[model samples]
Target: MSYIDGFVIAVPNANREQFIRHARTFDPIFVEFGAIRVVECWGDNVPDGKLTDFRRAVQAKENESVVFSWVEWPDKATRDAGMDKVMKDPRMNAAGDLPFDGKRMIFGGFAPVVSLPD
Candidate 1:
């Protein structure tokens, strides 16, 4: 089974283009480091919930939008090693200034319990 790294972020709406450019520049590094795929999704219909919601999870402001993204890896070992290399890779420093607030981002690694059409 594949390993997954999921992320949710709040990005200022005005920075949408900057965010895409940033992703395009850096997302490929994950592939070079062994990630099978990287997907970034800009929120389209995310709604507020009475108790909890994606918006509140990252404390998204009125001027911001939620971004849901993930990375697919062959397995945990590969993901761990690749992530280490990614951090040490020099190209990471080339992506100047994050388009979103890193402090408000939420991320985690997940093991799939169920997948469709297997």
Candidate 2:
């Protein structure tokens, strides 16, 4: 089974293009580092919740949109090795500022329980 790294980020709506550019720039590196694929999804119909929800989890503001993303790797070992190399790469070191509020971003590694092929 593959290992997964998931992320939820709150990005200022105005910075959407910039954020996409940043992701586009880094996505290939994931594959280069042994990831099977990197998926970036912008919030389209994210709804608000009184108790809990994606928006609430990240404390999304009116001017911001939530981004759901993930990277798929063969396994945790490969992901760890790839991540190590990725962090050491010059691109990461020089990537400069993030277009989003990273402090509010949520992320975690997951073991997939079910996946139906499309």
Candidate 3:
């Protein structure tokens, strides 16, 4: 089974283009470092939920929109190695004043509990 890192972050609506530009700059680095896949999805269809539902999650703020994304690797070891490389890459050295609150970003590593083929 592959290893995966998942992320859910609040991106300021106004910075959407800048956010994507940053992500695009990193895509090649990730691929060269052994990432099998890099998938990024904007939160166009996120359904209302405790964490995402504005009325329920007190933390949900007005200026931010959700960004759900993930990266896939052959396994945990490869993922870790690739991430280390990614971190050391010169292009990633400075974030260049990102638009959102980094502290508020949520992320995790997940072993796929279930997946169905198309």
Candidate 4:
């Protein structure tokens, strides 16, 4: 089964361009480590919820916007191996240029139950 690594983050609204540049630079490294595809989405219409929401999930501030992203891998084993390599790569340490608070980023691994026909 396909595996997915998903992420949700809060980015400073003023740093959209910088965030895109960072994503562009780093996304390929994930692919090199065995991710089949990566998708990053900038939130356009996310709304506030009384119970909980993307903003609350990440504790997004007034000046920040939400970003949802994911990386797909052929399978969990492939993802695990690739991620180990990815973690060992020195470039992962370069968080200085990140436009958002890395600590607040939410992420997880998932096994997909359904995917629409393409």
Candidate 5:
């Protein structure tokens, strides 16, 4: 099975364009680093949930709109290796003025339970 890294982060409405710009800059690097897929989506339909919900698992913030994303890899080892390279890549570093709060970002690795075709 493939390895997946999931991320949910608060994004201010005003900075939506900035966030998309950063994603566009990072997407190709992620692919070049061997990520099989990179998916990014705005928080359009998150359900209301408590703090405990987010602490226990991936969930949107109550007062903040979010960007939910995932990156897929062949396996854990490959994911780790690719991430190391991605982190060191200069293009990734150039995204320094990221529009969102890095501290408020929630992320993790997940083994997919199911993935349906669109």
Candidate 6:
């Protein structure tokens, strides 16, 4: 089974293009390191919930939009190894170059439990 890394972040509406550019700049590095696929999604229909929601989860502000993204890996071991390289990669270490607030980013690793077309 494949391993998944899910991410959600709040990016300022004005930084949409910057965000895409940043993703384009760095996402491929994940593939080079062993990710099978990387997907970045800009939220268009996200809604607020009474108590909690994607927006609230990341403390999204009125001027920001939510982004949903993920990386697919062959397995946990590959993901772990790939991620270590990703973090150590110099490109990812550029100072003050992130398009969004890193503090507001939410992420986690998941193990898929089922699939529709197995």
- TM-scores for every predicted model: 0.97, 0.95, 0.84, 0.94, 0.82, 0.96
Across 1-118, the per-residue lDDT of candidate 5 in tens digits comes to 7889999888777888888888888888988988999999987766556655432344334445767899999888889999999999887877777788787788899887776761
Clash counts per candidate, in order, are 0, 0, 0, 0, 0, 0
Clashing pairs in 1: none
Candidate 2 local lDDT, 1-118, one digit each (tens): 8999999999999999999999999889999999999999999999988889999999999999999999999999999999999989999878889999889999999998887881
What candidate 2 gets wrong by more than 4 Å, as runs, is none
* Candidate order, TM-score descending: 1, 6, 2, 4, 3, 5
Instruction: Give the alpha carbon lDDT tens digit for every residue of 9-42 in model 3.
Output: 7788888998899888877788899999999777
- Evaluated at residue 37, the lDDT of candidate 5 is 91
Model 3 stretches astray by more than 4 angstroms: 50-58
How would you encode candidate 4's per-residue C-alpha lDDT over 1-118 as one tens digit per residue?
Answer: 7999999999999999999999898889999999999999999999999999999999999999999999999999999999999888888888576789989999999999997762
Tens-place lDDT digits, model 1, residues 3-87: 9999999999999999999999999999999999999999999999999999999999999999999999999999999999999
Residue-pair clashes, model 3? 0
* Candidate 5 ranges with C-alpha deviation above 4 Å: 50-63, 113-118
Which is better, 1 or 2, measured by lDDT? 1
Q: What lDDT score goes with residue 18 in model 3? A: 87
In order, candidate lDDTs are 0.97, 0.95, 0.78, 0.93, 0.79, 0.95
Model 5 lDDT on a 0 to 1 scale:
0.79
| Residue pairs that clash (backbone atoms under 3 angstroms), model 5 | none
Task: Write down the worst ten-residue block by lDDT for model 3.
Answer: 51-60
* Candidate 1 residue spans exceeding 4 A from truth: none
Q: Which stretches of candidate 4 lie over 4 Å from their true place?
A: none
Best by lDDT: 1
After the best TM-score superposition of candidate 4, give how far the Cα of residue 113 lies from its true spot, in angstroms: 1.0
